[model samples]
Target chain A: MALTIAIHSYKGGSGKTSFAINLASAYASVGKSVCLLDVDLKAPSSFNYLLPEAKHWVNDIFEGRYGVMDVVKDVSKEMGTKGAFYVGYSNPDIVAVRGISSKDRKWQSKALKLLMTAKRDLSNAGIDIVILDTGAGVDFTSVNAIAVADYVISVGRPGASRQRLMEQVIGGVYMPLDKDCYIIENMCHNDNPTDLSGKKFDLPVLASIPCMCDVAVRCDNEVLVLTEPDHAFSKKIYDIMESLDKITS
Target chain B: MTDNSSTEEMIRLLREISGKLDRILIQGSADNESDDGILDVLDVMTLLTLPDHLRTTATALFELGSATADELAERTNKERAVESNYLNQLVRMGHVAKNRKGRKVYFSIGEGLGK
Candidate 1:
């Protein structure tokens, strides 16, 4: 089976989705079978960035209208890269998000189980890595997704308030999870992690990625790692990919 | 419902899923999922449940990625005679694959419903 990874954060706008896509691309570049799931059911972003015309979304997976395999879009050919690369999108329509995450206890549990089955089914299809770009902050779907994951890479920004919030989350929310959890401080002014780390947060900071216009400009449309594998931002992302490869399978 | 042992296995599968769902509620964290219970609903059940022998064999094979009959026998805790029959039936059912090397055979999960 494959290792499940959740790109999560306690704060919004931490670039978790961007990191997840690039990391997935990096893994696929190495001939590893990978799938990037846009499971942020509350607010979908990957479709806007990668495939705006996606017909099947993660919403269909939750609605039980489609199996995980049915909705999987093979992005490897579009990526113009090697290995198997797939993307499962989430419905960007307001109605879909409302229905998926609305106040219905029964529906929520069933939906969570379906998502778990989705990952399991994907692994059954010989995918070596499954990465979920979950919603920011503590949400039911995010927690359930993380619970089923084997490894978690929590992304955060470099700020006093965000740092404090993360410290609380790492202990309160993320600590109890019995999985290999790591942190990434994104949007750093410089590459120096020690300087950006500031106060000692009680979590393993895996990579400190700098803010680059190169990334921000292309993120709206193209994937930086796929388009420019030798860019500065792409190098840092590879550094993260290499670092994760060592710790995780 | 099919047989006495099969009924017990169905119950076990339900309890396994129900208990896992309960953990989300038990944790009671901000993001922890809450549910009344699986016992209350009839239609909302997810996590496609399989028959007793099929589930034990299929889940073990899918989870382990691949296994030989002997290895699967240990995983599902069945006698060699019984387990071998189960594996062969699964292969014939198109739920599993049988790879042969000399006299040894390795079994892997195949494209079966809910597998």
Candidate 2:
């Protein structure tokens, strides 16, 4: 089975989706077959970021117009990488179903089945890494994504509220799954301390990303770190990805 | 000499009507596609209900997440002229706040907008 990593945050503006997309691009840059899923159904930004180069109809997959494999588009070229990259789109109705009920066992089961189907399809296409960009906050969907993940990268900013929320999310919900979890501090400034060595959180800090203007400008159109490789921000992203590899491997 | 039960019933009826209005506003849909125009006007009318910075930041944050300053800059090739034009629009609309985190200037959706 491919390694599945869910990039999640308890609060919005934490760059969870950006992290997931960059991580997938980074993994693919190293020749790994990668797949990314935008689980933030209400605000599906990945498709907009990865479109033009992205193939495989999202609506087709959701409407049964095409199998999951048929919708797996190649986004590696856009990232300037050699591996294959595909983005999975969520159906609004399914998202509504998941959001509408926490106690609906059937909905949960069906959602899991859909995820598994997606995994199987990607695996068949030789994907080695699966990254899910989960919705912000400790919602039912976020919890479900965490539960199913083999590894969870909790992205957060530097603040007490963010930390407290992270603690609540991990301690109260995800910790029970026993999955390896890492914290990534985004939008870090030069004045801010690094390593978060003694910051006192439930998880260890895997990476601290400095705020990069180039990156902010690029959005999700392409991988900033890969494109700029030598820029300070990109270097940090690369270093973080390397550390993540050590932890996951 | 009004009965208490009748008064309570009247209050309940008003509450139901108010609840319906709230739903309509939240949903932003109805036979009045033009209702959107009216809602915009109402939002402007109630602009005093919130602080100017708060309104600006709220709009900025949503727009930022839907996209981002860095992404916008990249689309325009990091040209200050183009970037300023876009950023100015955000600033004017109160959807983004300008902040300097170091040498790099960052525009984020105003404060307390993160869900």
Candidate 3:
């Protein structure tokens, strides 16, 4: 089976999706089959990043209208990778988002099953890694992803409030679930590196990515690791990739 | 032979045959249970009865069909002892069944469950 990873955060705007796409791309760049799923049904962003037109969305899959393979968009050739790269995008339409948000627990449970089946199918199709860009907080959507994932990368910016929220989530949710959890401190502005030792939880820090003004201002969805290989942000993402490799290996 | 000696021998043989029958009946019942418990194409949402942690463990077991605590620990990124604890919890909840094979114990979803 492929290693399933859910990139989650305590709150929004933690650069979770960016890290997920870049990390998926990093894996794909090295000839590893990768599938990046935009599971943040509430706020789908991979569309802005990839801008690929879709015949189907994850919503349709959850509703049992389509299978994962039907919705998977292969971009391996476009990515110029030796291995395949596939994406399962969430519906980005307003009605679609509202519809998913309105889903009850029963629907969520069914959706989780569908996702599990989809993951197994992906593994059978030779995908090496499956990365889910999950919604923030303790919502059912994000919990579904966390439940299915083997490794969780909880991304949070460097701040007291974010840290407190992160600690609460880690202690309350991740710890109880006994998941292999890691923290990624994104958007660190301090000159000196931020220390994670003071945190309440014991999750290892995967990377402390410094904020880049240029990358922030670019205002486009192109993966920095793929577009600008020399960017500092790209290097940080690659470092995260290496750390993941070392750990998962 | 004395009459009492012959009767005692007959009783001993009957007791021995009864014990063997009991063992065979017990083994047959277990086999029936195993056959009945073979979950196939089951809806994964049937696991909602369990807590999230146990549900995750059960789901992992469903994926694996059957696995030891060590193998489940690898899949779940948890300590072997932790996985063992959760597996035992599932066993208690009747969501999973454990069997010993050699020195290793393997667990799988109990009945009417699949990934």
Top lDDT: which candidate number? Answer: 3
Lowest-lDDT window of 10 residues in candidate 2 chain B? B39-48
User: At residue A206, what lDDT does model 3 achieve?
Assistant: 84
RMSD (Å) of each candidate, 1 decimal: 14.5, 21.4, 16.2
Q: In model 2, which regions exceed 4 Å deviation?
A: A53-67, A91-105, A190-202, B1-115
Write model 2 residue lDDT over A1-249, tens digit each, in one string: 778888988788887777777777778877888888776655565545454444544444433467767776676665567778777665445554454444333333234435555666666667788898888886545665665577888888877656767777776555545568888899887665434456554368887787766676685666665676777766776788788778777
Report fnat in order of the candidates.
0.03, 0.00, 0.03
- For model 2, what is the error of residue A140's alpha carbon versus the real structure, in angstroms, after optimal superposition? 2.6
lDDT of 3 at B75: 89
Instruction: List the global CA lDDT of all models.
Output: 0.73, 0.63, 0.79
Candidate 1 lDDT by residue in tens digits, A79-114: 876889888888788987787666354556456557
Give the distance in Å from residue A128's predicted Cα in candidate 3 to where it truly belongs.
Answer: 0.4
**TM-score for all predictions?**
0.67, 0.60, 0.72
Q: What is the TM-score of chain A in candidate 3?
A: 0.95
- Pick the TM-score winner: 3
Regarding TM-score, does 1 or 2 come out ahead?
1
- What shift in Å separates residue A212 of candidate 2 from its native position after superposition? 2.9
Instruction: Write one digit per residue (lDDT tens) for candidate 1, span B1-115.
Output: 4699898999999999999989977677533322323222211112223345765566455445667888888877788778888878777655566789888888865422220
Per-residue lDDT, model 1, residue A179, is 53
TM-score of chain A of 2: 0.83
